[model samples]
Target: MTRQSISITAPNDHWLKAQVENEEYASKSEVVNDLIRKARAQQDEIEWIRAKLIKAEQSGFTDESPAEILTAFKEEARRNGDL
Candidate 1:
């Protein structure tokens, strides 16, 4: 494992200390690493949604009603195990 030397604000440092005291994490390093992992995952999800939106936009306007479109989307999500 690589060692890091970084500074954090008082509030952020306090939060990390609290996490360790609460036994939610083994150490500040673990808390920071878990947060980084979550942030990376969130970014990936955002990129995926952005790609999907771009594809939809490029497909042009649709004649489907809002409700119909939502239902279809939900059905597709279920089929893909996304919902």
Candidate 2:
């Protein structure tokens, strides 16, 4: 991977240092990498929720039961060899 020097604000730099020291991250790079990964994951989750909302709107679907959602997720996991 290509490494580039990017400037960060003082507050963010301090936060990164503290995260590295307190969060058991191996280094500042690891802390930054974790932050990036988490942010991307959260973004993907938001996109998925948005898509679900759009589909629900199109179908005029009502709210689903929690148990149904869990069962569906378990079934999907099994189908994907996650179980």
Candidate 3:
């Protein structure tokens, strides 16, 4: 693996060091990597939502009312094991 050095604010540096001190992470690199992984996952989710929104727009309007849309959303969420 390649290593890179970067500068960060004092507060941010303190937080990273605290992770190690608290034994939540073995090293600052681990904390940074975990944060990066979380950020990447969030970005992936954002992109997915964007794509779905665009597709929904292209699909045109729906006749479903707000309550009906909520019901369908709950059902879909349950089916997907997200609820």
Candidate 4:
């Protein structure tokens, strides 16, 4: 575990205090760590989505009919045990 001293301003300081006072966090460090964790997770999701979009763009369009698409979707759901 690492300990560091950092400064925060007015409303942000109040927010941290409120989080600890409200028992949302055991300490201000917990709040900061949680925020960083959430931010990193969101960034990861954004990167995943970007990669998917690029892959789809590179894969080009499909010519399958709407009914065929629906059938394939249902088959996939069944295969995945989602149906």
Highest-TM-score candidate: 3
Clashing pairs in 1: none
Give lDDT tens digits, candidate 4, residues 1-83.
Answer: 88889889999999998999999999999999999998998677556656655555556676555455556656875799755
lDDT of each: 0.80, 0.73, 0.79, 0.76
**RMSD in Å for all candidates:** 5.4, 7.2, 5.1, 8.3
Q: How accurate is candidate 4 locally (lDDT)?
A: 0.76
Question: Candidate 4: where are CA atoms >4 Å away?
Answer: 62-83
lDDT of 3 by residue, 26-61 (tens): 999999999999899867765765665555555677
On lDDT, the candidate that comes out on top is 1
- The number of clashing residue pairs in each candidate reads 0, 0, 0, 0
Candidate 2 TM-score, true structure as reference: 0.66
lDDT of 1 by residue, 1-83 (tens): 99999999999999999999999999999999999998998678657756655566567777555456556766886799765
Cα error, residue 65 of model 3, in Å, equals: 14
Instruction: Write the residue-wise lDDT of candidate 2 on 13-63 in tens digits.
Output: 998888877967878888878888989986786577566656665675657
- Clashing pairs for predicted structure model 3, backbone only: none
- Worst ten-residue run, lDDT, model 1? 63-72
